[model samples]
Each structure stands twice: as structure tokens, then as C-alpha cells.
Target: MSEHSYIAGIPLVLGGNVFGWTAKGDGAFAVLDAFYEAGGRMIDTADVYSAWVPGHEGGESEAVIGEWMESRSVRNDMRIHTKTGMLGGAELYEPARVLHSLDASLERLRSDTIDLYYAHKDYPELEIGQIVEAFDGAVQSGKVIALGASNFDAARLGAALDAANATGATPFTALQNEYNLVNREAYGPDLQALAQSRGIAMLPFFGLASGYLTGKYRTEEDFAKSMRGGRAQQLAGGKGPQVLEVMDAVATETGASLSAIALAWLVRQPGIPAPIASARTVDQLNELLEFTQVELSDDQLARLTAAA
Candidate 1:
């Protein structure tokens, strides 16, 4: 099996969770168009996206992306990274279930091949060898180019890697987890070190701390603006404001938006190449895109790291 890097030239993976949920139809298309026009190459989506909605049954985001790609004729120029094993409300990581979900994802994305396919989360109850073999089958079948593990702890990830090595199955090439300025415990030093040692690319989701790091959700009243405000509310009572203060200082020093500083800090981490974030509008996307141009100094990064 050949090892492949999932990231292209850009250091941002556009999150597709907003599509068909908060941003739909022309709005979703506009954001996607702006992202690609700004040199974004990868999009992160899952088959279970928008399932929490009242009338939705998931795959809505993938269908929107599929239609967008078909309409824009930009399939060849873009890298689509999607996840499975998190839907169907059934047993997770079953070999047959994994393949079945993949086929459904492929159908929704309107693509025969996926550049990168991720297991949405680790199922420790399942044998690592079984998971490895299931994902490896996709690679051998030319359905998925690379395999990734999301929301996996360091020890479990290491075990999965060992299982792959012993069985000669394709190993995970990327890791996706809840990593950001305010939330560091999940993907802390141990996990970062493991990823670096294993050469697994890190693409952290919730890179903006669910909008708390965006400087828009400062006071309790700010939570009233979005449906996901509860997440920001939880951060408000803790170190969220303190972390924002450090980000504010860095933003002032670099003239970058709070979103950019947050993402820039993520990119500077040891094994991270990009951070996954979503924008409901072109304006929000522009703010996030600024991170590509902003460079944080060692001191600024250190201060942010220490404050969080």
C-alpha cells in the first residue's frame, strides 16, 4: 500500500456541517465557491451530518456537495474527505457495515473514489485488526486513497497502528479530534507526540472552539445569536474569555481576525497541517481565510498556549 498525504496546498479543511442545516441551497453553494476560489482544496463532511435536524435523515451535506461539484465542474480540482461508521444508529465498526456506509457515502458524494475516508470515531470494543482490515479493503479496492481516525485517544490510536503493522493492513494516515485553544485535553501532549512520532497528519475539528474563540461570543447574551450557543455558553464560565484575551493580544500584534489567530495557532502545532472550521457566510469564511496569511511569533504562540 502507498502512503498519501491528505492535505493539498491549503492549510484549511472547510467543514461541511453547516451545509443543508444552517446554510442551504444558494448559501451553501456561495460559501463553497468562495472557499475554493480562495484556494481551499479539501472539505470535511460526514454521512451523519444534519441528522439532528427535525426532518433530515443525514447525507444532506454530501448531497449538497455532490450537486455543487457537478454544477461547478470542479471535482477534479478538489479533494473530498468524508467520514463513516458514525451513522445508521447501529453497531459501529462492523466490517460489513463499514463497507456499506462507504458505498452510501460514495453515492451521495457522486464520486467513485474518495481522497480520504475517516472512521468518525474509534470503537474500542471492536478488534483493531478488524477495523484495519476493513479500511484496508477500501484502499485495495480503490474506493479510498487514505484512511484516517477521528476522535481517537492516543493509546487507542497507537494500538490501532500496531494492529495494522502486525497484520500488514493499511494504517491510519491522519487524525481528527476536538483540538483548539480552549480545549486541549483531548488532543494534548501525549496525543500530539504520538501523531508526530507516527507521522500521522493532524486536522483538528472545532478549531474555533465552537465560535468562542471567534470573539463573537463574549458575554452570555452573545449566545443568543446561534443555535449552537450552548457550546459557547459552557466556555464562557471557564477559560474561554482568558484564551480570547491572549488571542486578542496576538490579533492586535498581527492585525489578524480572532478566527485567524485561533487557526494560525493550530497550524503552528507540531503535527497539525490544518484545522477544520465552518463558515455560514462568505464574510465568516473571509475571516477564517485570513489565517493563511497570518504568522504568529513564538512568544505569541507561547502566550496563547500558556493562557489556555
Candidate 2:
């Protein structure tokens, strides 16, 4: 099996959760266009996106991406990564179910092969062998180029890797987890150590702490800036404001936007190959794109890490 390595140039992975839900079709197309025009290539989405929205059956984001790829005709220049196994209709780790889900994703993305396919989350109930067999089967079928895990803890991830080694199945090459200056517990020492030891690329979701670290939501009233305000609300207390304070200081020192600083910090973190962040508008995307060039100094990183 070919090992999937990390790509440079654009360090941000555009999140597609808002494609058909908040941005709708046209707005999503505009955002995607701006992203690609700015040299952004990696996009992250999932089959279960926007399912929490009322009257939505999911796969809405992938469908929008498919249409966008059709309209833009630049699929060759871009890398698309998506996830399965999170939709609520049924459990997804079963081999038959995993194959069926991937087929559906391919149809929606209008792509023959997914550049990276993630098992949306770990399923401890399913035997480790079962997960490996399912992913190995997908790689063999050419429906997925590589496999990854999202929301996996260190211990479970280790077990999964052991299973892959013993069975000689397709191994996970990447990881997706909630990580940022504010949300650090999930991907802290344990996960960081495991990924570094295994050489698995880390793609941290919520790289901006759901926009809290973006400096757009300073006060409680600023939470109305987006529908995902509840997430920001969670960061308002405790060390959230403290983390933002350090980010603000670093942004000021480096003359970078808070959003850019937040993402740049993730890029500097050990084991992180890229960060998965989202933008609902072209302006928001522009701020995130700044991460491509802004390099955080060791001192700035130290301050942010110490604060967090």
C-alpha cells in the first residue's frame, strides 16, 4: 500500500460543513472559488455533515462539493478528504456498511476515489480487525486512497494500529481531532505522542476553537456572529479567554490576524501536518489563508502553549 504523505503550500483544510446548510449552494460555491483562487487545495468534509440541521438527511456538503468540482473542473488540482461512519441511520464500522457508505460518498463527491477517507470516529464495540478489514477493502477497491481516524483517543488508536500490523491491513495514515489553543485536552500529550511515534499526520479540527480564537467573538453578545455560537460560548469561561489573550498578544507582535495566528500555532505544533478549519464567508477564508505564509516564532509558540 502507498503511504499518504503530507502536502505543503496551503496549510489550511477548508471545512465543508456549511456547504448546503448555512452557505447553501451558491454561497458555498463562492467560498470554494475564493479558496482555490487563493491557492488553497485541501478540503475536508463528511457524509454526515449538517445532519443536525432540521429536515436534512446528510451528504448535502458532499453534493455541493460535487457540483462545485463539476462547475470549476479543477478536480485534478485539488485534494478532497472526507469521512464516513457518522451518519445516524445505522452503525458504520461493519465491512458491508463501510463499503456501502463509501460508494454513496463517491457518488455525491462525483469522484471515483477519495484522496483520504476517515472513519469519522472510532467504534470500540467493533473488533479492531473489523475496522482494518473494512478500510483495507476500500483501499483494494480503489474507492479510497488512504484511511484515517477521527476523534480517536491514544489507547484505542494504538490498539487499532496493532491490529493493522498483525493483519497487514491498510493502516491509518492521518488523524483528526478537536485541537486548538483553547481545546487541547483531546489532542494533548497522549495523542500527540502517539501520532509522533507512529508518524501519522495530525489534522486538527476546531483549529480556531470554533472561531473563539478568531477574536470575532470577544464578548458574550458577539456570540450571535454565527449559528455555531454555542461552541464559542463554551470557551468563554475558564482558560478560553486566557488562551485568546495570548493569541492576541502574539497576533499583535507578529502583525497577523488572530485567526492566522491560531492556525499558524497549530502548524508549528509537533506532529501536526495540517489543520482542519472552516470559513463561512470569503472574508473569513481570507483570514485563514494568511496562515499559509505566517510563521510563528518559537517565543510566540511558547507563550501560547504556556497560556493554554
Candidate 3:
């Protein structure tokens, strides 16, 4: 349906991977409050979030979001987008097993239904039709409004769409991939074509390149700032710096934060209704909120695109 994507009209979807890890309790609540008051309506989380952290098995972010929505009573006002198939691999994608995980995610999210549920990643070893049927099963139960594919390449996502059509199953309406300025390979020309043709909106993750595009990690010496600083260094070695250089010039001209400029650039791209990014603090969220105000001209977008 809706040409604006299922979430419809949200400028940004707040990333929730850091909710129970780097941000928690009052700190996490503050950021959530800021985002909501600033008109942010969607949050992207997964069953496997925070599992990489020591002592965290999984579902930490979901639980934290659940607590926030319950305590704040804003569940109806927000759109929740979460994923599955990341932790259990091929076996979890079995139709019955995938539905089981959907129940668990719904419980942890403290919701009767999820606005959007994604397959997390493509399991190519399994049949593409099987994967489509598995997620479509959730839609059949009315627990999920729409299905999405995360980390899926062009060929596989296209195949899954075709399978859904053949089987009369609900096709994926949203695509979440590792798309950003530096990492352009994840959502390249082929992927872009599919999203446009199928009317699937790409809610690109890592929109800030894990903080590299934020202009915080400009040099090797600045790599000690956070956990993703090493990734920043890797991004810095390639097109990261060049993109940041262009972003810096634009920021100077418009008095906007690099985070805002980066997200602003992403929103202007084709098939991207909104970009998914995270902020660890209220101050950080305010910086990200600046994206709503920063509008790039055609020439500026071209320069950032050329740099990337």
C-alpha cells in the first residue's frame, strides 16, 4: 500500500541496539523521551540485541523498550520494528520456530502486535520460499503488520519477493541493510532497483557509519573515544574521511552537526523514506534531531554522494 512505507511519515527510526548495553535506566529513558517529544515514532530493535555484551544473553534492548513504553504509556503512539533469525540461524527460520520467536519478541516488546517484524538476515542455505512463508505466517496471525528483510542482498531479496507472490504470501515492504556513506556495497545499484520497483522502503542502518561520519573520529589519535572507534579507523582509511570533509564544509556553512548532515544526506537519497541511527544520550539525540532541520541542496547532496 501506502507509498510512504508502513510506518508512514516518520523522519527517523531510533536504533535500539544500544538500549540495554551502553544506554540504560535513566540515561536510556532520557534519550527516549527526547526522541518522542521531538516527534520520533519508530524504534528498530532485534531479538539478538545486546547479546554480544558480556553477561547479556539476548532481548535486553527489547525489554528496555518494553519498560519504557509501559511506563510512559506511549506504545500506541510509537511504531516498533524488530527482527528475528539472527540468533538461531537456519533452524529458527522454520515456519513454526519463526512464529515462536515472534511471540517472544511481542512479549518482550510489551505489545499485542508489532508494527513491523523483519527476518533479521537472509538464510540462503534454506529455500527462499521457505523464508518468505515463515515471516508471512506472522502476518497471517495478525501479530505483525508487515514483514521486512534485513541484511539481504539483491538476488536473494528479489527471489523472496517472487516466492511470496507465487505463494500468495505477504511480501516484504521494508528493507534494513548495512547502508551508509562509507559502506555502500550493502545496498548498491541492484538492491536500489529492487526496492524502487517493489515499493519497499529502505530503512538503512549504520546511517552514521558507527560514528565515523559524525566527524568524531577524524584521525588515528581520536580512535580511543568509543567501542566503535576501531571501526571508525577502518572507515577513516577509505571514503570515510572524504565524506566527512564534505560534511565538514556543509556543517560550517549551515551550522549543523555532522550527525545531522549525515542523516540529512541519507534521507535525500532514493527509496530511503528514513534512516535508522542511535544516540546514547539526550545530548546526542538533540544532535541527531538537528537532522530534521538541516536540508541539503542538490549540489551538496551531489558532493556527499561523490565523496562516498
Candidate 4:
């Protein structure tokens, strides 16, 4: 569709949430540099990113990316994607508020136009049309080139799309939901049906299951390896280990890292342009970039899917 041209045929979209949080200073720059050098263009981040960390009031990731782009002189060569409406209350979707949020994100990114912007999550208390109109206003003003819905349920996403069509406004061309080998609850049958019917490109987040699928968190002591280790504890106790076993076999057979296998699996799925992932180091980034080269066989893909 003409409306989806902006994000068509895209490669990996390097996530920036870890920039100001886990990957800082030159470490973050190294990862960004590795991604850019590898022909990666799109970078996904959020205004409220890293705010959960004490003393960080959001925009930290954007500032890191902005500084990197300026230092490397690659701002014009990249497609930047960021989100709004997560920090504020329900009224943040108001037209003026949406514009204000866009301006703030623009200032942080040191760019005039955001290639793609997202409503970080839906405010179900408000009307869908009102939210769509507010976001479309940003598009109308030439601020954001495209819009996407993140963390939206199937029913809500359908209504929002319908509302956009009803008003001839800018419809969401992409979706940012959590869909990985193990965590398929958010992008289940109903949401998949809507996405398939509407031809929405899925740019799924947490595609690595927050490092669980990397085969790094096997033992109980492995949980102490990183700041995000605690988050993967639940996955370790249940079906996560089972899924990791499959990924390990695939990795051994393919002579690739588990990280690469995980990402490659997502890239092979239908309707997914690319799965969003972050690398705290250039080594990890290189591993993920390998997904572009690796092609899972039909049996490998089936086993991976069934393991989940």
C-alpha cells in the first residue's frame, strides 16, 4: 500500500532503549556504529525510555542517539522511530499534547522530521477517533512521516484503524507488539487476524525475551549476570528453558549464536519486517546482525515454533 511505503523493505531496526540505561558512553556508540556499518538504518526508541532508572527523567536514549548521529554524521542516513503518550496521562493523546510531544522528541533527536512515531500504548478511557486524529495531526503538520500502535489489543487496534479510515486520516502502518517464540499472548490469533487483514507490518519488541532466549539464563545464578536478569527469572522456571533447548540445537547445527538464531526465526515469520532488538555491545550487535544471513529451514522453523 502507498501508505506503508515509508517502512517497506526495511532491515533490522536497532533498538535504543539500552543506550542510556545499560549501554552508556562509548559502549553505546560502538553498538550504534556497528549497526550502521552493517547497513542497518532504522533505530527505535521512546521518549520515556530509561526513566524507570533513578535520576533518569526520560529522553535519555534519544539524547544518546542524537549525539551519536551528530558525532558520526549519519543522522540523514538513518530512519529514526520513537514513541509518545507513555509518560503522560490519558489526555496526552489530545491534539495539542501530541504536537507538544512530537516537538519534544524532535528536539531531543536533533531532527526536524521523525520517520516513524508511535503512540506507546492506548488509553482505553478515551475515544479512538480522538487519539487517531491527534496522531494524524502530527502527520498533517509534516512532523511524523508515519504512525504505529504499540501494545494495542486486537479489538482496540481494529477500532483505531476503522476510526482512521472513517476520517480519511493517517492510519497506523505498523504495529509494535510483543511477539516472540515464547511470548505469543499479545499477538495471538485475534491480533494476527487483524494484522493479516489490514496488511500491518509487525515490528515486534522483546523478540529475545529480554535475553532469556540467548541461553544465558540457565542456572539460578545466571540471573545475577545483568540488570535485566530478574525479569527473565520467570521464563527460566517454565517453558523458557524448553524453547532455549531448541534454539541451542539450531545454533549448533547452523554454527551460529543463539541470539542470531532467535532473531533469524522472527525475520522468517510472516508479516514481520524486522524484529526490534538492542545490543549493549558491538559483539552482541554483530550476533544479531547475523540474522540477515541465516535462513532457518522449514523443519527448524517448525521445531522452534512448536518448542514455544
User: Best candidate, lDDT-wise?
Assistant: 3
* Candidate 2 lDDT tens digits, 1-308: 11354343466788988898888767788899998998788889999987889998889999999889978898777788999888853367777888898999999999988888998988777777788888888898977877899988898888889989998898898999988887788887888889989988888888887788888887768897668888887865588888888887888888999988888888888788788888888888898888877888888889988986
Q: Of models 2 and 4, which has the larger TM-score?
A: 4
TM accuracy, model 2: 0.95
> Which segments of model 2 are wrong by more than 4 Å?
1-9
* Reference-based TM-score of each model: 0.96, 0.95, 0.97, 0.96
Better of 1 and 3 by lDDT: 3
Candidate 3 positional error at 1, Å: 12
From the highest TM-score down, the ranking of the candidates is: 3, 1, 4, 2
The count of residue-pair clashes in candidate 1 stands at 0
> lDDT values of the candidates?
0.87, 0.84, 0.89, 0.87
Q: Give RMSD to native, each candidate.
A: 2.0, 2.1, 1.4, 1.7
- 1-308: candidate 1 lDDT, tens digit per residue: 11355687578999999999999999999999999999998999999998999999999999999999989999888889999877753365767777788899899988888988998887877777777888888888878889999988998899889989998888998999988888887798898899889999888999997888899888667888779889877754588888888888888888899999999999989888888999999999999999989978989989999986
Q: Per lDDT, what order, best first?
A: 3, 4, 1, 2
Error of 1 at 187 (Å): 0.9
Number of backbone collisions per candidate: 0, 0, 0, 0
lDDT of 3 by residue, 29-91 (tens): 999999898888889999999899999988999999999999999998988999998786799
lDDT, candidate 3, equals 0.89
